[model samples]
Every structure is written in C-alpha cells, then in structure tokens.
Target: MSMNTFPIIRVVTKLLIPYILLFALYVQFHGDYGPGGGFQAGVILAAALTLYGLVFGLEAAKRVAPPKLMQRLMALGVLIYAGTGVATMLMGGNFLDYNHLTHDVWPQVLPSGQHLGIFLVELGVGVTVTAVMTMIFYTFAGRQHIT
Candidate 1:
C-alpha cells in the first residue's frame, strides 16, 4: 500500500511537526543546564523535516529547506562555533574561555559570560547537525536505488 494514499498520516504529520520543532528548541536552549544539548536537539529538528518529507515528498522537503540553503547554514554554523573560540582569544583569554566573553561595554540584560558563551556554541552545533542530517535524508531520498 502506498503511504501517499493515506490522508490520516498526512494529517498527523502536519499536527506533530510543529510540536517537534518546539521541543527541539526547548532542548537546545536548556541543554547547557541539563542533559539535552546540541546533538540531541539537532537530531530532533532533523527528524521533523524527515517526517515531513516522508509524508509529503522529497521535493516538498527540498522546497522547505533547499540544498543550497542547507549548505550555507552548515558553513555558517561552523563559523559561529569556531568564531566563538577565536573571539575569546581576541579578548585576551585562552581559546573558548567563557570568562572573557563578557566585556565592560556589554549589555546587562544578557546572561553571564559563561552562559552566553555556551548558548552560542550550542546554537552553532545544533544548526550544523540539523543541516547535515536533513541533507543526508535528502540525498538518500533523491537517489534511485538499484534493485
């Protein structure tokens, strides 16, 4: 039986996708304080995209997150992660030093330096991982397997 013929699956997928994305965000933001972190959140985010592709179609998934955009995101994520380390160095501290993340001129609304640094690094990791996993799904889906 073709899954495409089932309206129920599509309906459920549509209902669940948003919640999945929300949970991913929750895990991402709370990661440094708890068990969940970049890797788990990234996988969760990617799963949402994959579920949409499975219910709808590979082309649809690509439309939602184009390969070009994913590629650019991957690079941007890495840059963010590495740039954090470099920023600490430039601030006259050892690489990846959260203590140096704070500056005298920095706004007070944000969290402490350690928390802020962890947030940025985790954000980068989550982005890269989500892009990579989603791209992998797209790659496999697009290919015609020899049977």
Candidate 2:
C-alpha cells in the first residue's frame, strides 16, 4: 500500500503530531519531580516524528528533518550535556556537581542551580535521543530492500 491509500490516516496523523510533540515537552519539563525524564521525553519526541514519516512517507520526513540537521542536533545535545559537567568542574566542583551551578542573583524563593543543571542535562539528553532515533528511522526507511 502507498501513502495515497489512506487519506484519513494522513489527516489524523497530521492532527495528532502537534499534541504528541507538546506532550513530549511536558514530559521533559516535569521529569525531575515526576515519572518522566529525558529518555522518556526523547522517545516520545522521536515517536512523533516517526509517526509523521510513516504517515507522510520517508522522503517527506527527511525533508522535515534532514540528516545533516539530525547530525548537528546530536552533536549539539552531547555538547550541552558535557558542557554542563565541564562548567561545574571549572566552577571548582566535580563533574556534573550541580551545587557549583549556582548564581547569587537567583531569588531565595526559586529553585536552585541543581534544578537548572538537571534541566539542562535533560534537555541535552532529549535532543540527542530525538536526533538519534529519527536518524535511525531514516536509515532503515531509506534502505532499499533486496527482493
């Protein structure tokens, strides 16, 4: 079956992708205090893109998220994750020690640097995972099957 065979499916997929992405964000942001995190959020994000690809066809998906873009995103995410650790080290603490991420300007009523550090790290993880999974899907989808 080809993409044109299911117009309803395509329409439904289009309708759902935004909500899926939104939910992914929710999981990412609430991860530190709840059941979700970078990994779960990442998977959800990737799933949304994957659903788009399955519904709209692989080429369309690739156009939406090119391989070069995915590669850069993967690198950037890793850098963000590692940079947090390096920053802490430079701040006179061990790697990934969030205590060193503090700033005096932060209000007493607000959460501390630990929360900020975790958020950054999780953001990185989510980015990397999304790119990796999307790339993986593209890789397999782009391959020519031997008949």
Q: What tens digits encode model 1's per-residue C-alpha lDDT throughout 1-147?
A: 125889999889889999999999999999987789888999999999999999898888899999999988888889999999999999899999989888454677777788889999999999999999998988888888788
What is the RMSD of candidate 1?
1.7
What digit string (tens of lDDT, one per residue) describes model 2 on residues 1-147?
137579899889889999999999999999988889999999999999899888888888888989999989989999999999999999889999989887663667546789888999999999999999999998888888899
TM-score of 2: 0.92
Point out where model 1 deviates above 4 Å. Answer: 103-105
lDDT of 1 at 102: 84
Lowest lDDT 10-residue stretch of candidate 2: 102-111
Q: How many backbone clashes are present in model 2?
A: 0
lDDT measured at residue 6 in model 1 versus the true structure, 0 to 100: 92
Residue 61 CA error for candidate 1 (Å)? 0.6
Instruction: Give the number of the best model, judged by TM-score.
Output: 1
lDDT of 1 at 119: 93
